[model samples]
Target: MTESQFFTPHDLPARWRRKRAFTFVDTTFSAFLALWQRWHDDENRCDRLHVVALAHLPALDTPPPADDPSPLAAELARAWPMRVPGTQRLEFDAGRVVLTLAIGDDIETLLSRLWLRADAFHLDLTATADPRKLCKTLARFAGDDATVCAFTADKQQLERALQASGFACTPRDAYTDAPVTARFAPRWRVRRHEPPLPCEANAREAIVIGAGLAGCAVSSRLAGRGWRVTLIDRHALPARDASGNPAGVFHPIVWRDDSVAARLTRAGFLYALRRWHALESAHHDLQRTGAGLLQIADTSDDAKALAHAIARFAYPPAYVQPMTRDEASRMAGVDVERGGWFFPLGGAISPAAVCAAQLADASANITPRMNTDVTRIAHDGRVWRAFDASGAEIASAPVLVLASAHDAARLAGLHGEPTRSVRGQLSVLDPCALDALRLPVIGEGYAVPLGQDGVLIGATYDIDDADGEIRADGHRENIERVAGMLPALANTSPGIRAGRVAFRCVTSDRMPMIGQFADENAARLNARELSGAWPLDLPRMPGLYGAFAFGSRGLVWATLAAELIASQIEGEPWPVERELAESVDPARFLLRLLRHGEFCAA
Candidate 1:
């Protein structure tokens, strides 16, 4: 049935006057109905609604203390729809609407900060509710005719909060599990899913060149946007090269002093995690079960520095924590010698499974071009050509992305620039004794419990090693490094190492080179100083983009990088920091030099 059918008016006394902002105070079902009615009744505009998530959201059982040590309150305050922390102000839809979050045990601060006559007030007390506090705070903060939706499965608490805040909440169909008993609640079920986007525009077709994590993720997003995508990979399936690692670990690269790398990794990590959750539910098997990452301090001094960093930085609970060695061991299922900081959002995944799931989501259009190698790339003013085995053109698209790692740098047209390729070898151990150890993708070299096969150990970084052969020395080095971290893994009696070697592609600056392509001659000539060029127009290399030089931060950085590249091609707002985008621009460094009369092409 349509949403309009759900609206129900409140039953208030004649003397009690209700404002438009505070009008809908019926039962829980009515509160939802009012929200639905309001959303549907309003004109379809791109106006962002200011939201204030009032009330503490707790973990499973215990209620959050009145003054909790965690930063959840601060995070919620900063991330609230309207608020951007440290700015004391809220900008909605670029300042069309403003918001101020009221956070305090005192009722005055809560009332004063909650200024907006809210279109909807999300009163989530699913954690634990103090009715007296809820009533005192919301009663003063309630705007005229504003609709407030309060939640609590506890009948008494629900009634108490509703009566105090002048809200009348009736139960709606709860299709979700009850908060206390996560098992299915019989009366109502809440099927949590992404709300359907308003159907306004028709979908367009997209072609993504690589089927690695980046390509796979972007393809999934495009599909989510109702766009048909053709994901082409040289490999028959996905993750054939560096992406072929059996257990692809996921973690945000947190740095010291909230550096550029740390900030970028944080945003990218959050985006990736959200996208993973939004993907079709059937793909859960691909995601390995584990807590977030536990990043051990590189050194003791660094550990002290990290404690300070965690305090200063705005870290979400999902990804930041400083724990003692004892605490770290408890968090991770094993013994950690050094005290470590953990990213609660970090975990490992089966790379193959993620790729397969993305392809499956776009099964109708993501055509896999297996064993079909593209010898060279030639941009013919309009479209780029992809050649086959016998020098015959296979497929030509207006947009061509070179995501083939080191292979893309070797293509003749790009004038062999130095794209470093190194051989990385990893060993997978049997899960016999290692199963008991709690390995959570540790720092330096890690020992991860691979499903059934064993724990994955050792990843030797061999730079300038062109041959992607599994070197015994490299394997031994990895083993030694891992042994140093875990200590217990030194004994080879129970843990046998099975090596898998892959080549990593890197660039001079270590950033993944993305964006439009330039002629080899032009790039070489203008390679000294390049910056400040919008929609760069030199040689007409249309529909040519490069997504390579990822180094070893592939899993951590690829997905967001892919989206940024795609957005550049589509002329959409870049999905990353402007400086980062500039840093990765294919011709940014080269173009600046030519503009400054420093042409040095050999």
Candidate 2:
């Protein structure tokens, strides 16, 4: 059916006006784009419109016709995504309208994987294998009063399917070819779990611990959503911990196959770019490099395999390109290593600048309480309160977020101390030390050109070592590792007396903890009944969230982490897939312990 036939101008606006935020699911790209264009044109639209599109093919590669009259189509053409088999989120109308494109070969499998409360559905029945099965899957995501418009030649079969799936089909009109319409009004329960609802809070107030990248990112996101945030930190200013590094690199991971880490990194990398661009548009100087970054493979054979994989996957040149040794050397201005891939959008940025920009963006709604050490936190049923060394209350709110890196698990009172601290020491070289170097080059070790601030290099990852002093051996190790990639650095003298030491929080699996904390006390009380419970089955602490243990990927993971947490607090659709969110759930460790029957009654 045509777009207009499915959703007329008269009917679309009336439906949009009924809700503050609307979610629409489409199985075809053409329908998705058409609806999105219509939403863009509606001036009196809802506050937010989320459109989830599932496609068996990748995004369009060709740009829209230059002579085309539709500005929305042209805009979408410019923001087209790479040919990757995963979810890619695109924002429009200053982030008020979002399109989550799920690209994969199997539409049925893709639909089964998604987890969202869909308000409306635009289904192309011709694309699915079984209409009844599809209807059943759709019922799982349908919210109260959900509506569906389906295009199908077999109206009787479609009506039957919808009726069986708990949707009350409307009587057919005189036109036989018209689409079928239905409303979700089941006589019996159609789902095992209830649909997600908005979070119940007394007020739009929150207390976020730690003022680094994670904390500041959360604060900015919540504030942007009209939440008044209380940001507390032990240090006098933001980004004074792991995020205090002179500069850090940001890029997506590419393995032979699309692994979980690779997909998560890709999402975070893309989201970070958009957020950073927004910051720069607002005149915030992130001290970010425009030039691309080069990666040196450990072996030529490894580089060849990766290049083949890149070709097989058909990655766009704008995202990544395989580079020969000579090509890499030219890109880096000075590189002596094996062939590897180059990330055009990847480069180093000052972590401090990023944190400051985020905090500045939300200055109006953020209250920073600096130089205050939160000894512990306690929740009195409705509100969570922070206390200092002398047991004085530092801050309290109905919503609390722990973004204190290594201290997050400890503060949350999780068993087994699932996170560890890694001491990283970095060395800053003189300006003329590496004149041959131009852009950032990373592999075994990274070398970033900081312009007048000199070249930044070296980060020795010593696990569980808390020595805060900068040692001479750490500098030597940094120089040696970087010299392996940049040959010119090998001849430089060991006069690098300038360096800094900082600790990083990391988990054993390397994935960060990001989401609401599980109710350990409740779970322990019912341990026997919850042994085989899934991540979602575990009861969560009311209004308590976590966004820490990012390890070395803070620059890439922080922004996305914050978005996920804010979405959870507001009970909005998650920014990433449900499986991806579960991978980083703060209670994943606890869930594991429960599965292994490791808990004893208190």
Candidate 3:
């Protein structure tokens, strides 16, 4: 069920021809996992699979039944680690098998919020509410030539319900679990959503600007996909911006309601862990801190609220759990002041090292064209050519990626988009402060134990500040904030006067701007025609993309944003839902204007 067996060349329905198939399952998921394991073992099959399970309410507290080494229920129990509310994606077989389990939430609730096309559906009658209702839910997402396999004792009645919901019934005598199945041939035509049309040619050459975290990530993904990359940068080396920080912490932002930002951050954080692990196995020097991070909720109320959220979501102790002040003290080796939730996976890494590793890994397919400041980008009907200050062509390719932080929009001729520059200064203190500071803790600010570099602190978010020179005031603010939180770091201040300064590019919503840059002038001229347009409907500049506006979350946002761009370019099933993808869409501003009836008038 998790594999692409249902939608292959011979078995594929007409509507989903030549595309990766999305299969929906409504059941206990033990059967689905068995099918997934089978699909993973096959060597000849390569069809991509996206399996979404609108699970029937599970026995949330029930432990796995006593069994031997290999049982269907036991296998599922081991695989389905996060059984909390909302969506939890479990990837196996190296991303070939994606099982999205929507725990505690029903299929209809998820359908209302998500955008997906299900070409195949398997409904276990014992698991679903009503056969008719389940059929209706399938009709909403099923493609024109859909197929539904229903396992039920009352085959005749189930067939009638499916037929009423627009599927033509077929009852077979010799069937395994599902005695009856239905192939869709609706009498009434349904309005189906068409995906964004891929460009005429699947271009394999790309020119990426900026060699920072975002740029290196994009370049590496493209190179892995066999795309020849020309990595360009104005600076002599990469990671010279905010990514130049000695060490920055990585953790998902948690919210009571699990806001879009929080959800995306969780996805990003998980993907980054997978990516970092692979990088380290390949011998990349990440210099990561795997001892976990403690997000100190210094105030009693803050701690209580955080604890409530940790239990509310049923987040596993392995992922995140609340700890007492005493427990935290022991974990940090020497800490006293705050109790908070600890993310066992959250840790810090040198950004420059990660960037260098990505470039080195992609060295075979990536060509460096450094010290080339791209002043302007021009698309001559086919290829996008970048020009230097003296009007010399730096590099040109069919695809152009702008990952140059604040300069991303300017280089792509999208200066109208809002991107604020904030000056940040990080103070590096001597090893004297290292006595009690064990891990990174965020309160008024962050306190990072930078090992040999000593304790790194201070980052004043000075908005609209373009000056990149380090300041004593920034260092003073950093030291005061950390001392206020840890107290033990108070004496480490005099040595913290030395630090580094970098400007960060952040968006109003605090989400990174990703995806294709919309042709705003074209959108303005044809505003009336696109008045109620969605993101995919917006006219975009072909071959021009962005992965900037990461703000202070480059570590968390890097791999996911890179994967999103790669998926879009390859026309693969998106790693994110449509709503999540739209939340970070570069065309969001243009769509906002059109929605408010301002684009046409402007």
Maximum-TM-score candidate? 2
TM-score of 2: 0.95
TM-score of each: 0.65, 0.95, 0.85
> Tens digits of per-residue lDDT for model 1 on 44-154?
422333233322111111332446443533432333321111112222222222222222233323333332223334444554445556544444334433344444556
Candidate 3 on 1-602: residue-level lDDT in tens? 43343333215333333444445454455445545655555554445556766654454455455563556447456654444455555655555556766556565565444445566666657544557766665665666566776667677777877888778876566545534677778797533454333344456899999899999999988887677999999888988888888888899876667888888888788778767876897899998987889877758678788889888877778778897888877887666477877888898898999999989988999999888798999998899999999999888898899999989878776635678898998888876654566777776788787767677887899999877788888888887887766767676545752688888898888888888889888899888878899887888898888999999899999888987787677654456667888999988877887887786635
The clash number for model 3 is: 0
Candidate 2 lowest-lDDT run of ten: 56-65
> What is the Cα root-mean-square deviation between model 3 and the actual structure?
4.2
503-524 per-residue lDDT for model 2 (tens digits):
9999989999999999998998
- Relative to the true structure, candidate 1 has a C-alpha RMSD (angstroms) of 14.8
Candidate 2 deviant stretches above 4 angstroms: 1-3, 6-11, 31-44, 63-65, 173-175, 431-433
Backbone atom clashes (below 3 Å) for every candidate: 32, 0, 0
Off by over 4 Å in 3: 1-44, 47-104, 111-119, 125-146, 152-180, 183-189, 196-199
lDDT of 2: 0.85
lDDT, candidate 3, equals 0.74
lDDT of 2 at 242: 84
Clashes counted in candidate 2 amount to 0
Highest lDDT among the candidates is held by which one?
2
